[model samples]
Target: MAVTTSPVDETAIGELKAEVRGPVLQPDDDGYDEARTVYNAMIDRHPGIIVRPTGAADVIAAVNFAREQDLLVAVKGGGHNVAGLAVCDDGLMIDLGLMSSVRVDPDARTARVGPGARLGDLDHETAPFGLVAPAGVVSITGVAGLSLGGGFGYLCRKHGMTVDNLLSVDLVTADGDLVHASEDDHPELFWGIRGGGGNFGIVTSFEFELHELEEVLAGLIIYPADEAHSVVRSWWEFISEAPDELSVWLNFSHAAPEPFISEEYHGERILSVIPIYSGNVEEGWDVIAPLREVGDPIADTVEPRRFVDWQQAFDESYPAGERYFWKSHNFKSPSVEALDHITDYAVSPPTPDTRVSVTHLGGAVNRVPSDATAYPHRDADFLVNITTRWHDSTQDDECIAWTREYFDVLAPHATGGTYVNFTTEPEGEQSMAYRENYERLVALKNEWDPDNLFKMNQNIKPTS
Candidate 1:
């Protein structure tokens, strides 16, 4: 059976106000508009009620209220999703934004992170102790969404993905019961939450094991756009034998007006080779030196810097209030044909903000078994993320169409799998995300949330 949702009346609001200590906002409320706004400016939603929970008790109370009232529920952590599932139309919004807290245990090398915390929060807390967690490139992205969807960034090659290091999570199930899941307890639930997204439940807190790191040899090597074809071909062959300590990614986009890039190349299409080496600085230099010779690089800015600063280097580039449409594909390896397609389509972007990134994944990522966690694409060697961003709402159709058309051109080389967080739509596309694990997720959904109360995410359709 499906839930029957409705907008709560005034008397019901008085009752709900007693359930939660935090603010309960309605459409006409003073802060209602700001509460519904999310990271993607393209998303504009109006929830019937917005609940900003202060802690687990408040979360439990809000869930119970929603369950009894049959109000559709939307969970927002950092609110940085491309699909904007964080806010929904005429539902109950559980705004976890107020729960941004981070507690690090220097002795145990672990950190307990609140759902509302961003990647920046995690790094800031752990950096002082010489510890860091593997996460996405963008520091402003929500830790809850990134870790739940299998995070990867500069430390991915040396350490494992964020989910792999996850020790436990405190979740509020549909029953309004707070449960702790880990390898030792509720093992199935633990496995499901690793890459299952928010379909299972609302995660209040995440406990992750940390790795030791202070400085890294990290920077960008820029090449002219005309040399993309040869550069991409050579990059593919080089990363195959790369060590686990060295992680590299390729970006095809218009050059930002930065000091590293030449003045004439600003606003012009260019290819960038970004690398982060976590091993000995001297040894890292030896390994990455050959990359500078791949093509005639217009600039070379690779140098040793504090790892924490490097992680947040691009925070300003992807600010709030920009229309965004992102599409992605997982590949075992991009063939020569795929490389040609990537180069051909990258030179002329639909918008000035459009960016195509090819991230090399292997080493620690491939070492895990396919079904060990809900993240099923362990064998995937590369992930291609195409981002189309612009300021004007009128250009929405043009931007979305370009992203889809470009995605279709590179479909054959893909592994028929996708990163759950990167996809923009639901339904037929959901199957590509979980692959062989789809059946298992369906069973979990039936057992945990039988009525599908939490269907705002990359939905796992129930067989009713």
Candidate 2:
């Protein structure tokens, strides 16, 4: 192995500028601060330089250049990492934000997307063809990071995880080789890449199997806050036996003073269910009628809508600007006692923007064998994500404490394993997130990258 002791040379800088198509924004550049920023405003990293590569060739050059200097490399796809691992201090940052192109195969029902594409960009391109991929529910999440972290979305019930639909990927490995991976080629690497975060390589492009998701009967159905117990109990019963075509997400929060919500409900705690029915609209209507008729909903906005429209529904409320502290747990069931705990927290949340959300975790996601990929929680019924969102940095301690307390209170119900996508702390609990799969991940890490060049993610140590 070779290493350079001298500081970044002028010739090396010139070589980098010549290879990349996009701008190489250094600390002196005008957009350096904005370019290096992740979605969370709380991340205050100052990378030595940020390289926005335009294509695989550019990415290869960037990877090789960093390797030559033995510098740390941080790969930023959607910049939505809660732990802010996308950027690092005194390291080389590879920003893939410019690779936002989507190419759809309408006849085959598939799409080949660039690594920089967001969920919204992919949806808008594929929806016109009456096709969709299992991307994140939020529109702004990057396809690369989300898909690699084992994407969970509204379509998981009808379809599967984003990684489950992944047909192939074009990645630049630690050796700076641009290789294509699929079931037919480098299958083990493909399997590891499906849910392995940024541990193996930097993905430049992805080929995913899309579904014919033309019309969706989806939106929010809000019930009064006090009625959470009844609604949640009925919801638990209704979803347990509901057909595979329906996927529902539950939320408890103070009603925002938006135009769609009633004025009287503003600032009042409420329970809302966001459902996406992938089958016929009439069938969806029949499936969700039980909840609508159970209580006097402050609002019921479920109806037949374009698939693209439904994907962007939550973007406004959870924008990129807010500081966030998130904690998550996977449960065997949404027991009444668990609902009781959530209800107790909802009435008096730490902040107005604080929320507790439940995402259905069964269906195609559970069909995969537990050791098939890096994602573990195969048998869990629901994923409970407790988030504390506030605008001011002064509230950081209070917000994080509230999230920790909620997780502590609900710990009795949790199965101990967690979803790494929603994980923040990268310590003891983080190690448990992978469950029994941690050993296998270590072997894969050693085989592909012994030096830990890609150690800037939810790290799976080579010796762990």
Candidate 3:
């Protein structure tokens, strides 16, 4: 005989719909399928109910209802998480899609943003003021998840990670209480949320300290695949003494079929470097000259461009619904042997969409004290991510194995620490990601959320 689970009560769902202003969706609802779809196509979960919350009150109502019904709760902001933490099977999903909004205070040099806002939405609102909040490279990523995981991008070297710019956060706690966390109020919760993942609550809004940024000298520069080892060596040396105003990331992958790239190099394995100078354009030109002179280049798009334009440069490559598997490591430095191993993998990728990115991480990122927040890897010199993307589900095992193998080969050179945002598993090597702060975070988790209501993310379980 086969067993079947009981369905959620329709009467209870109706009561929830009447209590909240936003729409409540059940499995049979018209928009339920669309609401449950996340950024990664690899995840296919059917939540019991989907709540589209328009404001904090709706979130409070949804959380309370889930608690009363003893149902698991999953929160979705932009739903861009690689691990698909935003959706859960047979649970209630609190979708914040309708709450996308941004309010900038030019005089205060700060912006208050809704949790559902993407990087592009925040950038569009802040660009007119010649200010921006330091965020990740992908524009579609949610501000809440990125900031909570310690965001890094082109401006990271110049200013700092996104969490460093965070001024305040408004969240709904496990017990359905609305609270404001900052340096002054609920100081402990604020510290935990900084690079702590979503272990404590559902953050509804974020206040960020914006920095003045206008145009930047930035673009992509591609070199032949054979020169990868030498190019990496040169880049490593240059970054050792590079100014804080500049940030660069090296990509080892096949060349894309784009108008800017030469047709002959399309689909060919190549070494590409993206350098962005967030200072004076004239000085930036002088500083980036050596990088252009590296080996014989196939194509170069390095020139002056708007900072907003540079942020969205890689948007097209990472479209929604693509099957993506990622593995990352934090390293103080890479040895010559490691570079050679990386070159070997780059020369023969499982798919054309697979890419290995090495991002320099020493300027402002290293300046922050490790104990200041839950993010503890403050001294890492570089962050390496192995991304494997493919179209077919049948190729899942192959792509995943390749990513793991690549990480294993380079593990010897890594610092045993990984970025919380890049981790694909729910429970990562906790000690590595949190370092000495793991136990402290667990204690905080116990204090804030004893029941572990927000266990959908990279979870930090309560110690008690």
Candidate 4:
């Protein structure tokens, strides 16, 4: 009843490899297995070929070769995509992990970052200058994919979504030409790329306007697990009245087995209120004290730290090569019932690494009009993410089912629309996720890539 697809064309793949200026890995190459790996260990795709492009010219060459060979091609920035769109089975993968350059123009308050650059690289570069870009909370996330997907971070309340700060992007189109797209150049493409994911082309580099942020008062305050319900409720009411300069993410999980954590507390359920204040330290403490006082906290680690240090706060817990499954939903309101639902399941997370995070998404993020870019959920107060992590395949079902059930329980409270970056690869969900933006994206796809050469991502099929 079903037709099975065959393997990639060996001859064409071999030819394509020769065109890249950097290393090209074939199925039998020594580094082939490693090259095809993405951040999520759950995704194990075998591409026809993997090429690491060194620069814009290299990316152009790979794009042209893939188009000529009529091969499915995927662009991998940080390979941190939850859906694993960065690498596809039997497709050509343009791995950009090697391009990690970040050049900051302090005078212009802007930075030009390579596609392969990770959030950690960008943060480290900008930290010295007392400036930073709003990126994912996890430092290892690729700057390009996160930016293109309308990234939100701790600074989102004060600054804006990552796309809001995006100035321009250097893209290699399906036609094999390298072009710069910004507000003034290729305006249509620029608008689409901001929150559109990588539907149109492979972005070689991104230019973003940086924010002036110095020693930020940021860290976590951990309370007893039993107080999670009250703490989350208090947080919802408190953060809603917080000034734009203050943003806090609520996390409910077990204390991890890290060196910083006490041995007795490891695997014990805990309630943590992680806040970042983009303001003076003294004033920030005054604002954060109420949260620490909510329930008798077992530990209070909140203090003044560099912005980059705060960005990498979760790095140790979310190290690479682990099985990671996460789901996110934006909320118009944090109803009391939602908090109860979240804590009910959070009490027994499948793994110690499991986390339930509530990210504040209004303030600067909502200031931008809904129609300005492809990211449309502008009125949401908070975006809740259900994350599951485990090291063994035996526990895969347990971890995945937990995340799914958690979202299922809170479905009524969820704002139906999805953020492109946080979406899953299931067929019907994606189309309905980007509802209104769907038509505009389809039109843009037809104009730029009618052949669907870039259909490997959160796809927007061309309408003929």
lDDT of every predicted structure (CA atoms)? 0.88, 0.84, 0.88, 0.83
The C-alpha local distance difference test score for the whole of candidate 4 amounts to 0.83
TM-score to true structure, per model = 0.98, 0.96, 0.97, 0.95
CA displacement after TM-score superposition, residue 246 of candidate 1 (Å):
0.5
Q: Candidate 1 residues 206-268, lDDT tens each?
A: 999998999999988889899999988888888888999998898888888888777999988
Maximum-TM-score candidate: 1
Off by over 4 Å in 2: 1-7, 427-430
- Residue 217 Cα positional deviation in candidate 3, in Å, after optimal superposition: 0.3
Q: Which stretches of candidate 4 lie over 4 Å from their true place?
A: 1-18, 257-263
The pairs that clash in candidate 4 are none
**Model 3: per-residue Cα lDDT over 291-335, one tens digit each:** 888888888998889898888988987888999998888888678
Candidate 3, residue 413: the lDDT equals: 80
Candidate 2 per-residue lDDT, tens place, 164-238, comes to 899999999989998889999988888888888889899999999998888899888898887888888788887
Q: What are the RMSD figures for all models against the true structure?
A: 1.2, 2.0, 2.2, 2.3
TM-score for candidate 1, please give it.
0.98
Clashing pairs in 3: none
